[model samples]
Target: MPGGRLTHRDRRDIGAGLAEGLGYAEIARRIGRPTSTISREVARNGGPGGYRADHAHLATRRRARRREAIPHRDPATPPDAYGRDPDAVRDFAEQLAALMVRTGVPRMAARVLARLITDDSGSLTAADLVQRLRVSPASVSLAVRYLEGLEVIRRVREPGHRRRRYVIDDDVWLRAWMTSAQQHAMWAETAQRGVDVLDPATPAGARLAHMSQFFATLSDDMSGGSGTVEDALTVLAALRHAGTSLPVAQVATALGWPPDRVTEALSRAGPDRLTPAQLGALQGRA
Candidate 1:
């Protein structure tokens, strides 16, 4: 297999293959390269319809030269104030960014998110990001905007500060999770609306109804409300295991919860809310 950088001839062949309407895998097989290589080359230069061999080859050389001109950091350097090896931190950040890219994040946005997540303060101004990532201000701005839209990070201004900082906090994941659940709820609502508009017996309406139910269930699960049901079940399980009704205080002690929480769970686990098996497990607990 070809392992080194692609040559001009290789690019010409790629262009010819694209023009011939060949897929990336077949083109890669013919060129003795990986499909990923062929796909990335075409994507970075121009899409299949717009790709030109000469332009792509020249662009590759320019990019290579630019990368070569950047100064290399020595891994043997002393650690930072927090005793972190700078080179190691950079490699980890890049690895995290790559993983995010694989999970459908845009490349630049993933790089920005990874950098923010690894920072000691979990906050950075635009200038800090631009300097650390060695990218332009515009790139940083665009990446932050994308992340902000997803609720993964947020912007805040310190008192008396002119510039706003992008911050990732302990609750960042919670906020992102809620944002996703909210989106799912919107999808569920929209799907239900479609069901209402179409005949319920129609294939498309049935499909929409199923979609609505799926998204609604997923949203409810992801919204963190399912814990209530779990708590109720736990209360019932405690009573069932004892084979007798237990006071809220005793159940709380067994479950390591406050008595009032146990009482609330017990109150929610009434016959209306439980199945026959769950009601049997309840055993008349009050």
Candidate 2:
């Protein structure tokens, strides 16, 4: 009953309902309509306090007339029915680039990525990017190089053509994620070297140790997926099983790994790797 357009009488009723201090849900129930319908009607017109029945009805009629005046396209029609809509593509590209920039992507890089991504062929040459983006060739070169370094895009050589086409593969995200993890691992190793060079008893060494621990955890979480944590815990669990005080070097030799690898596993294992029961068992045996 409430699906059709609201009548002047319904609008009057809605105004009256709002005047009666009724919430949108209660007003909707009284009018036999949905709460969202009541909410949208009030919001678009003016709001609860400012929504006048006559004004809202007149505004709704004007909107309806405006919408009716616009021509609707049939889905069966070709995309370029009246010729290519350059404005539509430009608006779409602008919005996509803005969205990328909001997600921490650099502005020019976002524009370049947006153009390449929205291309019909899903690939583009450096010249094509420069033309579409309206930027200099040098600018395109910088953006493409940055995107390539981040693994967000890759270059492909055509069979006959000489200019390499830049493309975003489906596995771009996976490759970028792995690259970030690899970088974190490299940083963590560097921090650990800092820890070794500085005396652990000093404040600077403690800070470096903490930094190393944080990066090691982050690296494992990114690259190790769930398996890395499980493997580290397994190593801790084995050590817990040994029930003997062993040097980290001795543990490394027994595990047939470099001392640093064993140390990394121990660092990643964290203090809470084992349950209280396991810890108590290890403690009692010790």
Candidate 3:
């Protein structure tokens, strides 16, 4: 009965409340839900910066369907309303899985990602994912490996577990963003080399030079707030390690670099591409 979750129809009113800049308590009173609930929904989804009931509702629905079809005995929520309905979560997961498949993600990888993204717990061991996904051990291993390389998911350690958990944190997008920009930067450098090789004054050289300039500039813009994309990359990275103090070594290792180099780079790189594995290796040397 947490008031935090809104119904579909209630989303419209939430929009009204938001437009008027009403406080959480006022919004909760208007919606007949708990203030904490509304507060959490906004905080978890996007803070005060960008929130839309419609989008949140849709995301909730998609999450629910991925878990299972809504059962007949489920309580009637206001059109977009959601309660602690187990079936709704299942339904959302089920639907999301289907959508991802249509978009060309392999079925197993899509299911694993869907579950990781939607779960309120926000962390799950590979065994948990495998059990929930109902895929083979090898499939889970492969999917998790691919996701880790893409920097779109992470491994979280839990006490009493022999194996680490796999999770999609709020920062998954940050890792992805930095990874991409670094990739583009590398491309730009390569293109510059192409220009030098082909003759700087020739048509081919000019084209390559432009390619290099375009990517290098694009990479720069990606880091700034006013840049084309809000560097969700840094914000997302910040969201992880929310409560705990991240060890300097841990941060460096997760980014793959020696401590001094990491220290230098954090000042300079500011969320650009860096390898996590190499950093971890360097930490062992420390």
Q: What is the C-alpha lDDT profile of model 1 across 95-189, one tens digit per residue?
A: 67766776788878998999988988899999999888777899999999999888788999978988999999899888778889999999999
Candidates' C-alpha lDDT: 0.84, 0.78, 0.69
1 against 3, candidate with superior TM-score = 1
Candidate 2 CA-lDDT value: 0.78
Clashes of 1: 0
1-286: candidate 3 lDDT, tens digit per residue:
4524567877677767878999989998988887766765664343444567788788668767755753443465333344565645655675576566667766567677878888877778888887666557999988878777777788877787677988788877787788788888898999999998998799999999999999988777665522233433443364365655465687656656465644543455343355788677767796
Candidate scoring better on lDDT of 1 and 2? 1
- Candidate 2 lDDT over 83-111, as tens digits, reads 66654565567567766766777768888
In TM-score terms, candidate 1 sits at 0.60
> Which runs in model 2 stand beyond 4 Å of their true positions?
1-92, 102-104, 225-286
Clash number for each model? 0, 0, 34
Best by TM-score: 1
Once fitted onto the true fold, the runs of candidate 1 whose alpha carbons sit more than 4 angstroms away are 1-75, 226-230, 233-286
RMSD of each: 10.2, 13.0, 15.2
